[model samples]
Target: MNLKLVVMVFAGALLVSGCSTSKEEMLPAGDHSMLELWNGAEGGGSTARQAAAARESLRRPLTGSERQVDAQGDRSYSRTQEREITQQFPRLPNPDMVMYLYPHLAGGNTPVPGYSTVFPFYSQTQYAMPGERTEAL
Candidate 1:
């Protein structure tokens, strides 16, 4: 009971400290004017230069010769079709193992006929890397 009271008191103190809003001055006030600070010996930030460059780029349009790519119908790069992409990266084949179950009744009452079922050799399907030989040597 005494320990419980101590814990409650500590929690209350922590809660009160957290709830208290202290706006104490960290550093003494500086004795400098805005004009003096602006015209200091050291150079200011490059934001002004960056803003100017952005403004200049927006003002003028790039010439066709200066552009990286010409928007003509004839493109330099060839686009691969879905069929071509599949052919380029063919899927690795997982051999299927066929199993046969002898003729037997599935349930005591039911007379189920025998059938053949196929199962993959691998647990999960696997894919071949691009340019990897998928065909048997």
Candidate 2:
């Protein structure tokens, strides 16, 4: 019975404390200058309108000095200069050889014609010593 009474008192105190109101500070209203600009309320058009106006705002023709300087700068570099960047290590050439095949019976009973097939004397890739012939036509 004593524990029950203590628990009830604690619960009641907690409920009372939880029900108390806390003081909250209210913030003052701020100036909305950016919002007004976005809405185009200052004689400028709306957001899109302001963007279009801004683009056209700098549409004045370039001055004669600016044109002359730009033309001189553009002529300094040539875009038509051809630069053929060859590989550091050229490919090694392989010698070609002719191979003749005599007419013979192939696959079981079929007689195949004598067709010639040419193949390179060296492999697809071949390495040579420091002082050796490795280039060809």
lDDT of all the models against the reference?
0.73, 0.70
TM-scores for all candidates: the values are 0.36, 0.25
- The stretch of ten residues in a row with the least summed lDDT in candidate 1 is 38-47
Cα misplacement distance, residue 61 of candidate 1 (Å): 51
Q: How many times do residue backbones clash in model 2? A: 0
lDDT of 1: 0.73
- Summing lDDT over every window of 10 consecutive residues in candidate 2, give the lowest-scoring window: 81-90
Best by lDDT: 1
Full-model lDDT, candidate 2? 0.70
Query: Residue 34 of model 1: what lDDT?
Result: 58
In candidate 2, the residue pairs with backbone N, CA or C atoms under 3 Å apart (3 or more residues apart, or in different chains) clash, namely none
lDDT of 1 by residue, 30-123 (tens): 6656565555523455445566878988896869775745654335455658657777777789899999987887668778788899999998
The Cα error of candidate 2 at residue 50, in Å, is 52
* Model 2 ranges with Cα > 4 A deviation: 1-86, 105-109, 126-137
Tell me the TM-score of model 2.
0.25
Please, what are the lDDT tens digits per residue for candidate 2 over residues 70-107?
99898766453332112333346666888999999988
